[model samples]
Target: MDIKFSGVTKIFEPDIIALEDIYLQVDKGEFVYLVGETGSGKTTLMRCITREVVPTRGQISVGGNLLRKINRFDLALFRRDIGVVFQSFLLLPNLTAFENVAFVLEVMGLPPKEISERVSEVLKLVGIWRRRNLYPPQLSGGEQQRLAIARAIVNGPSLLIADEPTGNLDTHTADEIMQLILGINAAGTTVLMATHNQYLVDTYRHRVVEIHRGRVVRDEEQGRYELNGGC
Candidate 1:
């Protein structure tokens, strides 16, 4: 899905501005990295795309749908086409890996047979089929993350958003997770990832959008993690 933000600004009451006149465009099937320090509005930007928060000013258009124009009744329908992953993993402790992945389909009211097939397919795709019967507490950090990815993609979303997905993993495990994410992108899902890991950003060399103090500072294709004169 293509995303465009034009003159978008988000403000919190009592004089806090989370974003200021931001302009960005992400084409379909592109993998874009949102790089910034803590509280630099990266997460807020992702939230805008997900419609968790509306822009305080200007407009945001996702796949040609104007966010400001979407009614409350259609919000859930709009979100179904987008997938999101967070640093926390956010898996239910009581559910097995397979069940966790299947839960999304169930919520969407898919047929039982179809849910089984999709859950199985995604579990194997993320290389965690063997652990499908294990609960989240039983899996390693990397394994839990893989299961999270499986759940995120099980519904076949056209756009995927990952916020600091590798923040808690070691170098090797982080690399593995990134590889899985890249593989998902290669299979034609547009990915927008928010991250602060310089090594991963430099090594992967994707398009990078840098935000600082609620404003976009730099945007570069095949970009490295460079603070330079800008933050």
Candidate 2:
């Protein structure tokens, strides 16, 4: 799932410019890290890709489809090809882990049997199969996050976007989640992760795109976590 942004700018009400003249591209099967400080347009950039918010100016293309031209109906269809995991682990407290993951496939109108199979597969892939019956409140922070990742990938999406997916966990658990994300990417899913963890960014040594004050500061192949330097 290739993503391209050309001269993109997003301005909120009054005078807030969330992004400015942004140009970026991520090829298929690439694991790209989007790193920045709080409110530095990292989340805004992800929102643009997901179409949660439209850019005030410029164009974005995902998997060859222009975002500006996609109608609401077509946009809904386009979103199914992309998966998103968030820092908050937005799982339903009333639903079991299996049910939460299966809900995505259910919304897509898949057959019950197929939904069950796919949900089971992804839960196991994320190492949470044994806890499928647990509810969100019953699971630990790491377990809940794993469940979130399972839900995100249950549809076999071509692209996966993660926004601070490890922000709530301890170092050990964060490392585990990072490993799972890497494994998912290894299985051919294009990954774009937004995070502030410098250690993970430096250790992984993947392509990094750094943003600051609504502008791209650095983009590097096998990049480290450098805020004050350019690649």
Candidate 3:
């Protein structure tokens, strides 16, 4: 769904400012790219949306739910509507591919049958079903990433937040993963992806929000990674 950040500011202890007066709005079903240097506020902004880091000041809302006001009891429910994919493929090494995705539904307390159906559906969707019996360490980087994406989207979240998801992959593998992410966005899932890959950013030609030093420097529609640049 839609995300709105109004005058949001976040400061860590000992006077470390992670975000400052950040005001942004992402419409539902839009795919937006977050581009910035390392240590920029992109990750912090994503974390704020997920309530992993509460805003030190101002307000943030996702689908009309005020983040700062959400209580512990409702936080889990709120997070169910969002999916996160990290740069490192954070798959369970011990669990098989199917079990890794199944674990998410299990924790949500879904019935065994329903979990089996949903897990199967997503594993196939990510093209990892044939490798369902494989453990994380047994899969290639691309295969592991596919499994990670499958696990993230198994719950059918409305919002997908990815942080450098293709960073650790080769060009061809990264392109494959990017296409899968684009397909998810095409299916009307709101996407916020943080990346340093200029080729993908420019080629995709989606909305670009550039952050620098904990502040938004630019926001553009159908924007390239850099001005006067194209893939």
Candidate 4:
């Protein structure tokens, strides 16, 4: 899916600006990294894309659907095509790995056989198939992350939004998680990853969009974490 931000600006009450005159476009099948320091409006910009927080000014379109134009009835259907992975794996503690992924499909009213097949496929893809019976608390950090990833992709979303997906993991585990994400991107899922891992940003070498103080400072191809006097 493609994402376009046209002169997007966001401001909170009491005259606080979270984003200003931001213009960014991410094409389909592209993996772009959103980099900035803490409180730099990175999360707010992403929230605009998901329409969780409406922008104070300007417009955001995802996969050609204008966020402002989407009605309440269509919003749920629109979000089904978008997957979100958070820094904290928000898994259901009472549900096993298989049940977690299946829950998404079940809510969509898919047939039982198809849900089982799809859940199994994603679980194997994320390398958590053997532990499909384990609950969230029973799994290790990496395992839980894998389960989260599996659930996110099980719906075959066109766009994947990952906010600090590897933040809680160690270096080695982070690398493994990156590999899985990259593999997903390779298969034509547009990825928007907000992260602070400079090493991974430099090593992966994707397009980078850097924001500072609610403004876009840099957008570069094969970009690094640090730029000339930029974040």
Candidate 5:
């Protein structure tokens, strides 16, 4: 779970400079936030780490692979170290919640018996086992997001990365999602979240990496969200 980024930059053609010379690291089991206003390279940074898009320059090494250069052939092995949950929940609409989670294990070619057990465990951990038979449309926003979290973790990856995980939910639902994520971190999964929810920052007080423009402006241990009006 050693994630190290140094001098990383991503510039799309037509000159949209998303990130510039960014550097950061998160060791195993640390919960941290990448906070900023929209278009502040939060998603771009996540993409760079997960190798959805390559960095235009510099290096991003996670778990042992050089993300900038890993070929598609090697990607599956690389992804095995990390889990990602996006704001959209990204569940398969046709699959039941259990199957949505079970899909990951199936991809890894795990035995059905083990996959079933792990999926059950993760659903319970995310507080959605009772709803396992339900499809995406039948669940509430919070439940959908929880299912996303469950799906992300069912593989038991070393790092968990989430982006705007509760952006669409009501404050209470968002808080519940936050607590579930915090609980994941508490149970020894490293979480690196990209969020704009300042209240969650003040309330939970984890480490924070504040991204302004395209750079990491602050990396605070025991972080207190210093917004326009203080936290």
Candidate 6:
């Protein structure tokens, strides 16, 4: 999961520059935090890696795929190798937890038995196997978030992207969820997590990349949260 960003920039319009000439890298098996304030381009960087948005200039290579240069027709297969988790759970209100996990596998064209086995495995990995039959409406905030994590990793993606994953949870729940992410990282999924939690930023002390005003403001190993009264 080697990722390289070389002078990448994204401008939505004449005045709104989401990111500018960002150069960075994530070595294989490394865990990193992308930390910044609102609209600081953390999300933009993640989206660029995931191919959700196109870059205006420069280059980004994740694993072996040159995301910024890939053809539109080839994006889907590239996406399957990378997983993304968001602040919102994004669960289907009408679907059971089992169905939610199964849905991703189905789209990827796995066999029925394989999908069933994989769903059970990942839900348990996230500690939600018992709630597999429940709907999103029946779960707690943390539980819902865990379900989102389950869905993200069910396909066993080599690279994981989490954008403000704990934004919607309470403090204790946030801590637990962050722990879950770290545990996943420890198991060798190269992780790039975008967060605003200063407490979490201070606690983990992993590789940190800070963005400010659409630029890479700071990047450090085992970093602490600073600036704007954070940490």
Instruction: Say which candidate scores most in lDDT.
Output: 2
Model 6 lDDT tens row, 1-231: 889999998999777999999999899889999988888888888988988888899999988888866887678888887778876778999999999989999989999999999999898888889999999999998899899988888988888899888887898999988888888888899999998888998988898888987798888899987854233
Listed in order, each prediction's TM-score against the native is 0.96, 0.97, 0.96, 0.96, 0.94, 0.94
Which 10-residue window of candidate 2 scores lowest in summed lDDT? Answer: 222-231
Candidate 1's C-alpha runs over 4 A off are 228-231
Q: Compute the lDDT of residue 95 as modeled in candidate 6.
A: 96
Q: Is candidate 3 or candidate 5 better by TM-score?
A: 3
Local error of candidate 4 at residue 22 (angstroms): 1.0
What RMSD, rounded to one decimal, does every model reach?
1.3, 1.4, 2.5, 1.3, 2.2, 2.0
Candidate 3 residue-wise lDDT, 1-231, digit = tens: 999999998999989999889999999999999998888788999999999999889999999999889999899999988999977878889999999999989989999999999999988888889999999999998898898899889999999999898887898888999999999999999999999999899888999999887888889999888732211
Per the 3 Å backbone cut-off, how many clashing residue pairs does candidate 6 have? 0
**Ten residues in a row with the worst lDDT in model 3?**
222-231
lDDT of 2 by residue, 1-231 (tens): 999999999999998999999999999999999988788999999989999989999999999999989999999899999999976878999999999999999889999999988898899989999999989999999999999999898998999999999997898889999999999899899999999888899888899999998899998899988785223
- Please give the CA lDDT of all the candidate structures: 0.91, 0.92, 0.91, 0.91, 0.87, 0.88
Any runs in candidate 5 off by more than 4 Å, and if so which? 227-231
Model 6: lDDT of residue 31: 93
Tell me the spans in candidate 4 whose CA falls farther than 4 Å from its real position: 227-231
Clashes of each: 0, 0, 0, 0, 0, 0
Clashing pairs in 3: none
Number of the top-ranking candidate, with TM-score as the measure: 2
Q: Candidate 1: give the clashing pairs.
A: none
**Model 1 TM-score relative to the real fold:** 0.96
